[model samples]
Target: MFTRKLGKTKIEVSEIGFGAWAIGGDAWGPVDDGQSLRAMEAAVELGVNFIDTADVYGDGRSEQLVAKLIEGRRNELVVSTKGGLMGHHRDPNGEPVYGRPAKVIEAFENSLKRLGTDYIDVYFCHLWWDKQEETEAFIEAFKQLKRDGKVRAVGVSTENFDYIKHFNREGGLDAVQLDYSVLNRSVESEVLPYLEQHGIGAVVRGPLRMGILTGKFHEGTTFGEGDIRRNWPKETWFADSLAKVETLKGLVNEERTLSQAALRFVLNHPAISVAIPGAKTAEQAAQNVSASARPLLSDEDLSIIARVK
Candidate 1:
């Protein structure tokens, strides 16, 4: 496995990180503690040094399990979890009330207590507050946490192009977890180049495009209600994302899966610091980590990748 620096910070992570949202086991679907621990163990054994989690995920279940999973192995991983997105209190309309700083800090502290660790390796603003003052407050709160040794450094996770650059200039985040993939090239237009210029690491979240890139889902494939796949509407580019899968199918030999190809595509770019695709089982974790050492596609294959739907 290959490791790289996370932005200009001293933190170094495996190119493939363990994305722990699923370990929280709610929006993605129902998962038991036993299965969750196995998934975490697989990632660590395979040299995946970065783990991404959030406070609002399952309202602290994910963080606590992560704590137990990493209890003695803390020195080997770059554990990054986020705050913001108030937990379990949806409005009457069933929308999350995000960006309550005082409450958000309370959430962070709760995560710390649950993880049973004194400090988190990486903490991020889960999302922007949509107001300058609020965004400023988010950054300020994270910065204070860093000073108090509650977090190593802070970053932002979002897909908003305009907001990423604006926040970079104004809020001064150490990193930003932006969405990017061969299918999602919009970031290359400006956001990625911006991160490179500013020395802000970009931790890509959906390199697999919700497993659609695995080229295994057929037209009739359907996820159950509790599955995260159900959370994404059919109208989403990813839900009905078979177009890119078919395109990628044309690029690789039949034996190579879309999962490997998609990951390789993201790592092909030097600007991409790490790709944190989620894993629900040990097999999935092994499949993802293998991409780091795999041969990159030929230029011709890459040209085909660029042409993917």
Candidate 2:
């Protein structure tokens, strides 16, 4: 596993970190809980020390499972989870809720209890709330946790490239997570340059394009009912995204798996410190970890990818 210093924070993590959201099976697809646990165990066995999760994932079920998964071996792993979008799927609709000052602290404590750890290696603001006051509240809340020695670093996960640039330029965060994938290169136009200049490292999520880039689904297969892909109408993002993947596949033949190519492509970005891709099975986990072992593509292949409409 290759490790890099994440900006100026002096923290090191494997280039291929295990993204833990798949264990939730809420936003993604149907996942067997046992297989997911095995995947987590496989990541550790394979020498991946960093794990990323969110409080809303499966509504905290994910965190508790992680707690159970890494119980005594906490020191060997870097557990990073996100907070700030509260309320409840537990309440009524699948609406965006929030955490008050006290609730925010309580949420972090509860997440620790669930992960069975004393401190979180990294914590992020999941998405963004409407109010700056909420951000301030979170700043205050996490500041307390940091002062109390509960969190090692702070990051923000957002799709807003401008905001990522703004955050890094302002200089309070240790890291930032964003959607940076073969399909999502907008981050490179601005966000990545700013991060590099400001000395902030990026955690690239959705590198698989939510599995569309994995060479799994063909034109015929349809997503399950609960699958978030269902929410993205087939006529819109799915069709366009699938078409793009096919174009990319032509550039990468049987010489390499598109999955491998996609993984290598994202990590090759100079600004990326780590790429977190979710795996539902142990085999998939191993494949993801081994992707970094593959040699990078030539400049022409990347340009070919860039020209695909």
lDDT (10s digit) by residue, model 1, range 1-309: 899888888888899998888878787878888887888788789889899988877888889889988898787778889876543345467644433456456767878898888788888877644555456667667767877887877888886876776666664677889778877888887778878887888899989876778877776677787786764446566544676677678756654666887898888777788999988888888888988877788888787876763
TM-score (C-alpha, index-matched) for candidate 2: 0.91
**Model 2 misplacement above 4 A:** 87-100, 165-170, 231-233, 251-255
How displaced is residue 127 in candidate 1, in Å?
Answer: 1.7
Model 2 per-residue lDDT tens digits across residues 46-142: 8788889988889887887788777888887878899876533232543234435565677788888888788998988775533554555566776
- Residue pairs of candidate 2 with colliding backbone atoms: 67-115
Cα displacement (angstroms), candidate 2, residue 119, comes to 0.2
Compute the lDDT for candidate 2: 0.79
Best by lDDT: 2
**Model 1 per-residue lDDT at 255:** 42
